[model samples]
Target chain A: MLTCKDFLSELSDYLDDSVDSEIKAKLEEHIKACPNCWVVCDTTRKTIQVYKGQTECSIPLDIHARLMAAIEKKCAERGK
Target chain B: MSAPGSEAIVSEESGDLALARTGDAQAFANLIQRYEGKIFRLAQHITQNREDAEDVLQETFLKAYTHLDQFQGNSKFYTWIVRIAVNQALMKLRKRKTDRTVSMDEGIDTGEDIVAREIATWDPSPEEQYGREELAEILDSAVQSLAPAYRTVFVLRDIEDLSTEETAAALDLSIPAVKSRLLRARLQLREKLTKFFKHKGDDAFAYM
Candidate 1:
């Protein structure tokens, strides 16, 4: 069974996909038996899912166009 | 100006930096076009304001262009670009100290209180009220609330998906500083969410 310490310690890596397959398997097996760990996993998963979704802000087309122009202008100036 | 995946353009950018050093305008433009989004996003995440972000993006590209000749081929181009963007964002943030003081022992204010109010007003059905998207938005706001000192590390490591060493290199902070700040940021976010759940009761995560 995975204790709270084990589950919490590996929680971030599990979310980040940095944990090894062997440890992940152990975690999955433990979550199957431990409701507490399962809740931790569920909450943490929700947390990461929420983080990634909200962090995505579009790069405005106008801004993109302006930045490209600036870069082009810089390049042109350097060319001279 | 060229097709995004134009083979010719791709090859041009992938060609020697010596070409870029020798004033290859198209090559430099290609490099900037390729990296502008990521650079803008990094700045936006760090500064949490589009104006500041735009400034950071401009500064980053200008610095990169001026120092293009100094770049060794060891690190990835985007990595170097991000380093410049992060620096610009941090510098801008430091300059804006009068904007919002990260008060120690800061009491809950309108921003968080409003968030809590909305969470409290959520529908009885957790699935309906607290969907994945809602949760994510709340988490992002929590991250945005963190002081610049903490927010930069959290975004660079978790949000931007940079490795510890890469984050350290970008911020010019020690690895231990990055690790410690990242951990503290995550803990603060978790605590904030935990309180949200505790206050909101069943509507917070009854679906799970």
Candidate 2:
């Protein structure tokens, strides 16, 4: 029987789908039988999902202008 | 100006990349326009500051442009730029000399600390319950609470969608080290988020 500690150790690999079949099956069996582990697994998965869903912050206009000016200066220097 | 989320630039990236390598300023600017938003976001997440992120964004592209010939094309241009951005961000972090920075080599034990303290299941679609800006604030605060070592790994591996091998290479960590840090980061963030997302009637302080 996989203990909660054991399941915790493998949780990341399990979520990543990188665990071998035997360990994966054991993890699945453990989660099915253990609500706590299941919640941990499910919530952890959702945590990743939430972060991944975040849209990239757009560069502020002032910063964008500064970046362009810097690039233009550098290009001119290289040209010279 | 290109729209903020213009992924259409991807198909044209290779052509711009070729021209940019040959010192075409407009082509390089196009490349910057496509990736600046994402690179700025990446810098913000790692450095946890807007000023540092802006500097990193500028420095990363400037360095990339200067070293354009050194880019061997073994990786996607985005990935190559990401490496530069990450390094620039880390340099900023180090310069601040804050206590939050921990050596990535410090060994983390996956023992009792790994146990899930908040076992309550979350509301389905908990993120949907909050406004997008609120959710972003919550997520950012949660990530910022983590130590820099874990935060960097999580940002690169999870948020940036870098492959484990690529992340390991970028951070100069062995594969197992990356896996361990990522695991710790995920569980820690999960536990932190549970405080916000768990069921209403459930014991918010519930322990397994």
Model 2 lDDT per residue over B112-151, tens place: 5777888887899987889988998999999998887888
lDDT score, candidate 1, position B199? 38
In candidate 2 chain B, what residue range of length 10 has the lowest lDDT sum?
B98-107
The TM-score obtained by model 2 is 0.91
Off by over 4 Å in 1: A1-7, A17-34, A53-57, B1-13, B16-18, B99-139, B174-177, B191-208
Best by TM-score: 2
Clashing pairs in 2: none
lDDT of each: 0.68, 0.87
Candidate 2 steric clashes: 0
Chain A TM-scores, candidates in order: 0.64, 0.89
Model 1 lDDT tens row, B113-174: 11111222222223345767776566668888887777887787777767888888887888
